[model samples]
Target: MSKGQQWDVVSGVGITALAVAAARAVETGRPDALIEDPYARGFVGAARAPVKLPTTPAEAEAADGRGYWAQVSTYIAVRTRAFDDYFRQAAEAGVTQAVLLASGLDTRAFRLPWPERTVVYEIDQPLVLDFKLTVLREHGATAGGVHRPVGADLREDWPAALEAAGFDRARPTAWLAEGLLPYLPSEAEESLFHEIHRLSAPGSRLAVEAIGNIPGALADTAANGSVRTLGVDLADLIHTGQRPAPADRLTNLGWNVRTVPATETAAEHGRPLSPAFVERDARYVFADRPPRAIASSAMSSVIRPPV
Candidate 1:
């Protein structure tokens, strides 16, 4: 991927964002929905997707049976619910600041019940952010808290842009990297986390949707299927290679980390996913930095008393 490549809501990586919204819309209509995103369908309706994107369960059923869309819809629902809970838990823990990296078409700031005086920063390409704000504004949506959009490339110096936009590094933050890592090159992924670590304060938390390594054959098959069905070549957009696990990287950076397999999460949510659609190695990684007092106490305990 180029350093400053751009795409709108209907093309490139941007279409994937719309696809997720469509999945959310379908999930919202379920009687036993994991998360309610009333605005998800609106985003889908506004975009002119190159292929038929299902916004309802019936439409989704017609697209493919027990196929790509089926697995994606279920997985997206599970992933959305998991991240939603992560944010809620962070809020309950009194960490009021939040950042959504590559925050495309996600309506959390508008739908999630955030505490008063909370601030949410969304970082993405300028066009992507503009498109999202336009669609939401047309629907007369209001954010639950202070909403700031940082329009900059993640591969560039976004931390400076974030700081300029009043991101408080000293305050505990709840950061999310949902469905973003795969589009980033290996080096860029490393840089992204390093920046996150630098800006995060003690007591901050992070949640990531991490993908496991994909075999070349599987990758080619998936990519070919997507192009044939969706009219978009996902292979061109995705960066595939062996990289360090996000959980291990965060642990080494002094964050308490936990990894949960996507299949396990699906079962826990009572929605078992098909392995064909969901990557066998896909997982969610949640990590939190220790508060300063706890770190200080631990350091003190390790030191012997002066003779």
Candidate 2:
């Protein structure tokens, strides 16, 4: 489905963002959590619709099912930690500019201990970003870096919006597209990377969490009954089937790419492993645009997905 002209906290793909916030809030409450997002709980609290956070395996099962939701929670927790490390490494390497594409409820701009001179630009639907900012403001949350929010649809001219919001394309940037691509059609996904390749300066780092083909459990409407109880369908939100390979695109764009299995990341963090992790084509990919000269040109646009 194409993105609508507008969306709120509980409609379309926006609702999935709330679910992700819920997962993050629950994870932050964990004693052995890989990352702590203090704003996550507040975001959930401020949501227009009730968000059922999975603070424990029991809560997860109650929200979805005995096994599937538990696995989803573990997967989210693992994904959060891995992406956190990606930003840290980028900062340690002296890349001060960060761009979060389809940022959703991500609070990395406020939570992570960013190096001095770091500037983070978040790009997403206008209302989604507005809701997040409103909650953070109400809770008196402070940012760790220069946080700039660009309210624009990714399907449109978001790069222009980003540039207007003080994103410097000349500097190396740390870019993230987590839990995002599966919603876009294959052609849109490819066009997205093409834009990223054009906008990235050498030494830029990119991280993504994606599934080549959505898992049967998440794609099965009947199986996701527990998720439906909360008024959000995990399966319905996702655009399933084959899609563009981001790694291959980045490689052709002169970036060095590395991919790690989601299960391996979970194992490294000492988290539980489930078939959901090992029995799927899920992966966390990292690609770095090397410190070299880049061609000064804008990429030609391809056909946009059917609107």
Per-residue lDDT over 29-148 for candidate 1, one digit per residue giving the tens place of the 0 to 100 score: 778888899889998888888887888887887776645665678889999989999999999999899999999999999999999799999998888889899989999999998999
Compare the candidates by TM-score and give the number of the best one. Answer: 1
lDDT per model vs. reference: 0.86, 0.78
- lDDT by residue (tens digit), candidate 2, 55-93: 454576677555655565567788988998999999998
Off by over 4 Å in 1: 216-224, 293-306
Relative to the true structure, candidate 2 reaches a TM of 0.88
Per-model TM-score, in order, reads 0.93, 0.88
Question: Candidate 1 local accuracy as lDDT?
Answer: 0.86
